[model samples]
Target: MKINVEVDCTPEEARRAVGLPDLTPLHDKYVSMMMETMQGGVPPEMLETMMRSWAPMGEAGMAMWRKLFEGGAKS
Candidate 1:
């Protein structure tokens, strides 16, 4: 037996349908903090340490984050 069902919805609607907690607020706060950090609100060593802890994928994750910040800076 095979079944095919399609439900059209926006990403947010899909997330809600799946019972995912809304993280928009948390994401916004995180972005704001990141901006502050990039603008020198936090020291380099502390930022590195924090990134090490937050980026579970280790150096690769850090590199990805580095690319993101670098791109932002270029904008």
Candidate 2:
């Protein structure tokens, strides 16, 4: 047997129902940092190094990123 239920709610409400933590502040900080990088207040290499350090697989993750971009460029 199967039951179907329909519920209408805003995104925030849905997120709360699923017990997801609110990420508004984190998102705001990320956007602000990206904007600073775009304005040259932060060097691209520094941002890349920071991101690479944060990746779980480090160099391997960066290699995958390079491959993805190279494939996109060829297409």
Candidate 3:
């Protein structure tokens, strides 16, 4: 037997239901960094390429990535 699952709610409600906290500040920071890196604004294609390139890496790389993600690497 199979049952249907329905989801009806606003984006905020859906995020809350999944225990996902609102990440407006994080998103804003990401955008600001991307803009700074791009200098004259970043294109969607370049953003996709950046994401794809960084998506596949080991734990060490991920830690480095997170360090950069959280704003620059610690000395």
**The best candidate in terms of TM-score:** 1
Steric clash pairs (candidate 2): none
Looking at model 3, the pairs that clash are: none
- Per-prediction TM-score to the true structure, in the order listed: 0.75, 0.54, 0.47
Candidate 1 residue lDDT tens string, 32-71? 9878778875666887787889897989999987787669
For residues 1-75, what per-residue lDDT tens digits would candidate 3 score against the true structure? 999999789999989999999998999999888768766655657755676577676666656655664473243
Model 2 error, position 1 (Å): 1.4
Residue 54 alpha-carbon offset, candidate 1, angstroms: 1.1
Of the two candidates 1 and 2, the one with more favorable TM-score, higher being better, is 1
Q: What is the lDDT of candidate 2?
A: 0.77
Ten contiguous residues minimizing lDDT sum, candidate 1: 36-45
Q: Residue 10 of candidate 2: its Cα lDDT?
A: 93
- Score each candidate by Cα lDDT: 0.85, 0.77, 0.72
RMSD of each: 2.0, 4.7, 11.1
lDDT of 3: 0.72
Clashes within 3 Å, all models in order: 0, 0, 0
